[model samples]
Target chain A: MTPAIAVRGLVKRYGRRTVVDNVDLTVMPGRVCGFLGPNGSGKTTTLRLICGLLTPDGGSGTCLGEDLIAGRAAIKRQTGYMTQKFGLYEDLSIRENLEFAGDVHGIADLRARVDAALDRLGLAARQHQLAGALSGGWKQRLALAACVLHAPRLLLLDEPTAGVDPKARRDFWDEIHALAATGITVLVSTHYMDEAERCHEIAYIAYGKLLARGSAAEVIAASGLVAWVATGEGADRLAIRLRDAPGVTAAAAFGASLHVCGPDQAALAAAIAPLRGAPGIVWQEAPATLEDVFIHLMRQVPDNAGQG
Target chain B: MRGTLRRMRAIIRKEVLQLRRDRLTFAMMFGLPIMQLVMFGYAIDNDPKALPTALLAADHGTMPRAIVAALGNTGYFAISHSVTSEAEADALLQRGEVQFVVTIPADFTRRVIRHERAQIAVEADATDPTTTGNALAAVEPAVARALARELTGPLAGLAPRAGPVEVVLHRRYNPEGSTRDNVVPGLLAVILTMTMVMMTALAVTREYERGTMENLLAMPIRPIEVMLGKIAPYIAIGSVQVAVVLVAAKLLFDVPMIGSLALLSAATLLFITVNLAIGFTFSTVARNQLQAMQMSFFFLMPSILLSGFAFPFRGMPGWAQLVGEALPATHFLRVVRAVMLKGAGLADIAAELAALLLLLGLVGALALARYRVTLD
Candidate 1:
């Protein structure tokens, strides 16, 4: 099967600082790929480049078999890009926003498509409500509905569920999976680990560099990091003690438990040896979580900020 | 009170910092005053001189020649066109190419020598009454002085105190010299310029401010499609405004609509589109709605002041008139006045109409070129 997004050596720079540096990303058709990255790590920029909303300063590729630069208009027609921010007309009613999106895409049977989208979103009764008046979750759902109204082949969602409630995020992810089942490719950027895990695969980026790309299990297994969880009285207090310890990459408190991870099994074991025998604390070896793997990956790459 | 003072001081400092960062607003603050001072001081002239006059001397006699020279010497009328026929002179006056048409009769010198009350017809284009008012007053005195020199040798008594030549000053089109007749038509141009440019600028910029421009650009729609779609509604709004002003002009001001309403509508539509294109161009340059509004006002100040809407077009200095000539409002004012006051046909106001069309093309192209298809 042809890859939906096949971009190589893509470089985007603002002034002297390269935002997406020599990046290569490819996602096969009908695959839901979660784009994971820290803030300002060029996740949004990379998505914009693929969807033809931005022209790369260097390198070239194809989106949905169309040249990224030359066939931008054609790519735009078949690609749906949901921006990180709400990008619909707030003053416009829910129905009107959908209709506008449909009209811009030159969708046939626009009225029926808008009505069906409204009904599917459970917004048919509130179709006349101003988009600005809706809650964050509802607004996001409406934005999703609008972007997908044209039945685009590829959906580039930039933090589509950033501020949404968990229930709404789950529903949105379910809808994304459903779209993927229908042969629609989705590349969704997100901060939520669970959302990243829901993807068929995830690409982790740090400082404009893609550090890891694989399924959740594959990424975790390949991280080469050791993790130890401790749950007992005053166990959460151990996070502060292990945070800056040599060879300890990340130490964080999760409820009454402390999760610590670092690369190199012997060094991590040596770093945590002093706290292993603390009274009323039970320490057990655990497989590194996606968060642990990402934290390890982030620390491996030097920060690119203010270097340009 | 001390706490309040410290808090107020912090707020004041914050406001100053923000104002400094908004460079466009900062520039306008200083730039607007300087511009206003320069425009008002150097450009505006109520009593305009060098009014273009066409001398149609049927009799090229010494006295007629002397009278034309005297008219030129008044520092009022500039005899730019020397036409031989009456029809040619009428066309010049009708087209607003020349302000006054001076006609010396075939029997002018013969009548003056015979003391037969020789008549010199000075027909002024009186659409702008203020422009021609002072110039008209100087005609009879200037004629008497010229004839006094000519009637020296043979007939000294023929040069009477009231002047040997009878100056028949006919204010054509607006014979009554009513201020409302001139102002009402020009007001339509001003009203449309203010609203259409401002409204369209804000409309396009609002999308940017609201973050909808990104979504709009991401869509499959072309830049021209977006531009025309944004401009189309304003054209309808402009037409409604035109109707309102035209009805008001007729009913309240009793302004004459001598030309065809259909022709006026077509020209007004063209003018509206040009302003909308200008607004779109401004929107592409401005970052937000406030900047759009400021840019609109920047264009509007000169438009209202220099377009002959408020002051006489001929009254302004050469450089200012050149600046005014480039503006769409200036050409529209000429077209509207010619059509409404003079009952001018398409051929008569064709140049101004073409000027407006050229403005629309240039501004529309600029807007399209400046409109970014990508965020880059």
Candidate 2:
């Protein structure tokens, strides 16, 4: 099957600073690819380039098999882009917003499609309510409904579940997976590790560079990272002390246990040697997690922020 | 009290910093006053001078020449067109090219010598009464002195207290010189300029500020489609406004509709479209709604003051008239007044009609040029 998105050397520069610098991305059909990155890491910019909302400074690409630059209008017709912020008109009712989306795409049987979308989202009873008056989760759901109203072949969601509650986030993910199961390609940018784990594949970017790209297991194994967990009365308190250790890349407390990971196994072990024999303390070797691999990957790249 | 002062100072400092960052608002704060000052002080004149007058000299004798020279000496009537026939003079007056037409009848010198109460027809275009009021007053005195100078020797006794030469001043189109007739029609132009330009100016800027512009642009819609969609509703609103004002002018103010209603409607639609295009152009240039409002105000200030809606168009200085000539409101005001007050036909107001169309094209082009299809 042809890839839904195939872009190479994707570069976008805002004046002196390059926001998306020589990065490439490809996503096959019917896959949920999570886009992971630090704040202001050009994730939104990259998504906009793929959706033909922004022209790349020095790159060529195809989105939904249409030329990114020359066939932007055609690309826009087949792709659904949900901005980081709620992009639907708040002054309009839920039904009106959905109908407007349908109108823009020239969807046939718009009323019936809108009715089905409202019913599927459980927003039928409140379809006349103003979009602005809805709760954050409901507003986000309405936005998602509007995005897919045209039955697009590809969906690009930028941090769609950023401010929602845990239950709503879970439901949103279930909905996303349901859409993916229908053979629609999805490229969703998110910061939550749990959300990233839910994707079929993940791509991590930091400071305008794509650092890691693979499945959860493949990425963790390829990081060459070794992790050690310590659980005791005060094992969590050692996080601050091990954080600045020379060989330890990331040290954090998960509940009452301390998890530490680093690229070099012996160096990481030496960093925890003094506390190994502490009273009632237990040490166990463990496989590195996706978060650990991402933390390790983030450390290797120098921050290029504020130089813009 | 001391803590309150410190908190107030901090708030003031923050406000000052934010104000400095908004460069458009900062510039407008200073630019608006300076522009108003320069326009009012240098360009505006209530008692206009050098009003253009056309002279139809049927008798090219000494008396007619003397009267023409004296009218020129008054510094009010400038004989810019010297026509040979009455029809040519009437055409000049109807087109608003000349403010007054002076007709010297045949055998005027013979009648003056015989003391036959020689009458010179002075027809003034009084659609804008204020513009012609002072010029008309100056005509009788100027002609009296000119005839006095000519009534030497045998014609000396022909000059009497009432003056031997009768100045029959006909205030055409507006015999009563009603200000309502002038102002009511002009209100249509002013109201349309204020509302149409301002409403469309906020259209795109509101979308931008609300963050909906990205979604709208991400869709499959074209830029022209967006512009037309935004402008079409405002055109309907403008038509309703025109209807309301026209009814009020007819019923309350008793302003006559002497010309074709169809013609007025066509011209009003064109004028509304022009203003809407201008407002759309402002929306493209402005970054936010506040800046859009300021831009609309900046455009509207000169439109109301310099367009002869509030003041006299011919009374302004040459440079000010040039500025007014470029504004759509100026041409629309002329069209409305000519259509309603003077019963002007299409051929009579053809120049103003063409001017409005040209303004529409230029502003439409500018709006389309500024509209960006992508965020870049």
- Candidate 2: list runs displaced more than 4 Å: B1-160
Q: Report the poorest 10 consecutive residues by lDDT, candidate 1 chain A.
A: A99-108
**Model 1 lDDT tens row, A1-308:** 77999989999999889899889989999999999989999999999899878889998889999999999989998999998899987767788778777766777798899989998999999998878899999899899999999999999999999889999999998899999999999999999999988999999988888889989999998888889999999999999999999989999999999999998889999999999889999999998899998888887788888788
A291 in model 1: Cα distance from truth in Å?
A: 1.3
CAPRI level of candidate 1: acceptable
Which pairs in model 1 have colliding backbones?
A: none
| Interface Cα RMSD of candidate 1 | 15.2
Show model 1 residue runs off by greater than 4 Å. B1-161
Candidate 2 per-residue C-alpha lDDT over B166-201 given as tens digits, one digit per residue, 9 for 90 to 100: 779898887766666777687788778877787788
Candidate 1 per-residue lDDT, tens place, B27-103, comes to 64345333433343345555688999998888998889999999999888998999999999999999999999999
Clashes per model (N, Cα, C within 3 A): 0, 0
Kindly list the per-residue Cα lDDT of model 2 for residues A155-189, writing each as its tens digit: 99999999999999999999999999999999999
Q: Native contact fraction of candidate 2?
A: 0.64
The TM-score obtained by model 1 is 0.78
